[model samples]
Target: MLDALAARAAGPGRITVFEPSPHLWRGRPYGPDLESVLVNAPPAIMSIRHGDLGHYAAWLGGRAAEHLDPLLGEPLVPRALYGEYLEHTAETALAALREAGWEVRVVRSRVTGATGAGTRMVLGTEDGQRHEADHVVLCVGGGTPPDLYGLDGAPGFAGDPYPLRRTLDRIPSGSDVGVIGSGLTAVDVVVSLAARGHTGRISLLSRSGMLPHVWQRPVERQPRFVTTDRVAALHRERGTVALDDLVGLLRDEIDSAGEDFAAFTAELLAAETDDPVRRLRAQLDAVDDHRIGRRFLQLTAHTVGPYAWRLLPAADRARLRRRLRTATGVASPMVPVNASILMRLFDSGQLDAVAGVRAIEAVNGRFHISGDQGRRTTAVLVNAVNPAPQSIPRGAAQLVDALAADGTAALHPDGGLASTDPRLHVIGDLAAGGSFITSSIPAVAFQSARAAAAVTAASDSGRALSG
Candidate 1:
């Protein structure tokens, strides 16, 4: 959506998209059962366009008594309200596009397969139909789900959590339910179930029993930061920077406006991939913090700046990769889950958080979670674990096989699930770009923008480009 929007806004090629869950635009990872899932990221930071940061707030202002909206005091508003806010912003964007001469095509079909030959790409839809795109962008950023295999009576185990929102609609008023994760989704399930007045005993199961950390609102400033200096010192001294110290220093830098907090953070993230020594230190530290290790996985993303995650020197990257062995690591980017939701579940006593299910054998009527916490069962078992190429419909696997067979693309290992052709970009839970974190708007926005650019650049037949 961001790609098509940017393309149209840039007066580039006609923008067309194939979104599987077409109506899912209102807010994703959405549910008919969820009534209390609030946007954890403050609405202020959640806008698609940086220029429209407080646009939703202004609308709420108009609706406020004396226009003093309570939401202002607390930026995290209910998902439903945010849904409306998203609709309004999207409508405004769509209207603007229509007013322009660009023809935007949005097809509501799952892209089961895609391949490129020369300048044209062939894409297969869920309905067995194929379409052509000058360039194709796979919005596959939303990570796939788990495959429930060796667990007891597991073949009968149903592996759907997100789509099962409707299953929850008819759930008993107060039933005991077992959640399989302590991450954000688990949290979301608890909160949503709570909103429905279902006071059930919910247990969250995970291997490490780690819950996500909460996102505290921005606090008043403290001191200055030195990025290159810190990076230089870390490289020179080969040591760790305390989290608090780093945060304080970075905050000071952002306050000085010598750098964009966003850009600086982006750089730090980029550096994690570029500077080998730094990336190794990060991975080593992260391995030790298994409780909330994923947070560290992200803090060191591939950086465009000197501070982010990037490839270490061959030696250091190799060392880092070795240290990362025990960690539940990703070769490519994966969706970041919600942590606040998990904490909410724990608070409600709805989550019985446990880890490791040896097998999922069945009992008299339902399934048993036979493993770490002994045998207990639930009426249903939904696989909420993050999906990889191994999990989803064979469509992706088959598509990837075809890509390799045709010699049109090469897999980038850490799942580069389907990025064989730059002209054919992939996003959402599928890209496997070493950074799959969430199916959130922010994640998608970043992915879509990149996809749009690649597609646009690939489609350039006679256009002058501007940077």
Candidate 2:
């Protein structure tokens, strides 16, 4: 994203990147110690421009030293190393900008608040400092993790799986960890805990039995396709997808394409590997709602040609032929794995599934939770609970509420994702209303560019970026 910004503000302009976090370029999601959060898609899936291959990765992680590209296939790089690359790129960008007579300052301070001025911005810093800028880009990045929502006096849980590794070290070793959700975050916590050598037991509980698929390499390549229908397949746009139905639809699409959807997607990434995000977004822009009907079929069936015969449903294939394909609702029982770490825990009779976690209460020193199933015990209750976009925020919800009431921003309906015109931008998982299978490097870079452009325009117009 910084690269995109620098490229856009190539001419005479001043851009100040006000990042409060310790790690500026990498943001909070990519902390210093995160080395194994391998990107899922192929390198082709990443990009800034429509054809800029590996621009972000080349700048961030450098060319993959290995033959396999994690962004393209199942390769995983030390996420921390990626962070280093980002820092390096930011420095390089700063130097070039200075040499070219562009004014840029990367400040390390938390912006307490900002009021949008028509031609400028009034920004308050953490140390009670105040400043004005010609423009402001509110790249707040991801929000606090879903698990940290309601807990009080949470001195130490197992560890925060979010950005910032120092927070984890704050917790004492050998502490039993109670993970609230069973999905990816839960898995992430388990993996990180093991990495840190936390010997205490880790218990994971979630309403649904859903778990992410095991990583597998694609076997064969498929073809590009465009399905002209999709509304009926639009199920729970703001939440976890129906694993079985989603897999089934992709299975069918690949079958038609004469290969597995994964392989086909691999090929697509490889072909567009240079700048897949931009090209894909451009393609989506071209289609928009004009081809909503087609999008429905393409969403699920589209992947069928990508994933080989490894996983799918026979019933979905028959239904796609007889039914409108768009009529089938997109939700299905989640499939589990035999070798996954979470599955291994489940198999060990350590973790169990709860129908739903209704409320969390502080009973004595430990937190108590009640749900549809019943109550349970735990050493430390880490709220792995996913954020419910529709749910009302409690009394303490402050920043966003203040921002919305003051008319500085709006919310995207599907997930209440923060909406900003141009000067202000959101990135990472917190940004709403984008592709389901999205990446940060490219998609995030795209947003940063938009934000930076707005800032540059304001500075040129003798105005504020937030205006």
Candidate 3:
């Protein structure tokens, strides 16, 4: 939001930011963590500056090569290092806003409640202070990872395994570890453990045991058929976008690239039910695949995803929801570097992934897990389950509840704040009426731009009315 305002020179007003974390720009995911915890996406997609794809890469300059992950063929830098880029971008935006006659104040406090105050909105903070604003943009990050196993106070169990720096050390290097969930977060725990020279067996337990596909070396080809403009044109003509219509566009894109769409999608679906080790090995080998299917899906999943999602009929939306796990795995793939790490661990007989996790009990000083593969006990357990997209965080629950109770704001049936109220804006994962998938950085950047424009335009209109 600050970046958009600064870019537009929309100032001459005061802007107050409420942030309780010590790390200003880096939220929970990017805060100080082990170097092994990398930014999941490449620089091409991680930019916060909307429309400027190279913004992050430009900031990296010569430092890019130093943090390159060779297997991914892109600079998959550490999350902490990426946090530095966020901090730099934020400071630059603040400076520009100040120079443009904007008074920016940073309050190191968490907002607890929000209510309507005439034309303005009142925000109550945890510090027992209230402030009024013409518009409020809720940027409270994503929801907390749920304790699926009810292991909050259990010994040797990490309910939330973020900033692995704190959680990893407490785990004894020699203790056998069991990680819940086979997604990116679980991969982070495994890789960070290896980096810390931990010499214990590690097992990933999940319902599907499906791991994220490895990202292929990016190509220069742009989508010819699945572009947002094409989607908009379709919606104008048909009034709704069906699942078959989307598949048709994808088919055209793949065929135009001279690849067999049927074969590509077949392999993709098969990977979901394929053996873990074999699938990971195949993905590692296909890092340089020339096929355009995955790349096309990746590009459009964010850009055309939300827009198409809104226009999709209820039946089509339900169809997509049925395969949510597959969609998530394909859309958010792991870096080749981590895929290789998992393979090595598998080869060395130190790592394994099991599906059908039915029960997890904290036994006497150990974790006993029962799943499709029967039972296994580990000395330590880590919950790496990805949080549901746009679910409200525990800390901000009070504020959101207050708004919903007062009819000041409401949540979408799909999760996230509804767009019914103009006085209250939302960005990041909390924003409603977006793709069911969690908001990516690029998606968040787009939301921020829209929110900034709305706020500034309203301010301009108010001033004009007074004149």
Which number leads on lDDT?
A: 3
Error of 1 at 175 (Å): 3.2
Question: Which tens-of-lDDT digit does each residue in 1-467 have in candidate 1?
Answer: 55245443544445555656555556344423344555555455465553345656675564424322132234455566666766676666656655654456667776656566755667677789877666555444344455554443443343555544564664675766766654555556666666666776766655545444333223333222344455556556655434344455545555564444564455334432343223333333333232322232222222211132232243443444443312222312211123333334555556566655666655665667767667777765555565542122343565665555666555655546545555555555555434323334444555656555554554334222111
Top TM-score prediction, candidate number: 3
lDDT of 2: 0.48
| lDDT tens readout by residue for model 3, 359-412 | 999989999999789999998999999888878888789888988887878888
Q: Model 2, residue 336: displacement in angstroms?
A: 13
Better of 1 and 2 by lDDT: 1
lDDT of 2 by residue, 351-448 (tens): 44454666665566565667776876555666544344222233113445545555666665534446553445555444554332322344555556
lDDT scores of the candidates, listed in order: 0.49, 0.48, 0.86
Off by over 4 Å in 2: 34-51, 56-73, 126-130, 147-149, 154-159, 163-176, 196-200, 218-223, 227-255, 258-339, 350-355, 359-369, 386-408, 411-440, 452-467
Counting clashing residue pairs in each candidate, in order, gives: 64, 41, 0
CA lDDT, candidate 3, residue 291: 84
TM-score of each: 0.67, 0.64, 0.97
RMSD, one per candidate, in order: 9.4, 11.4, 2.3
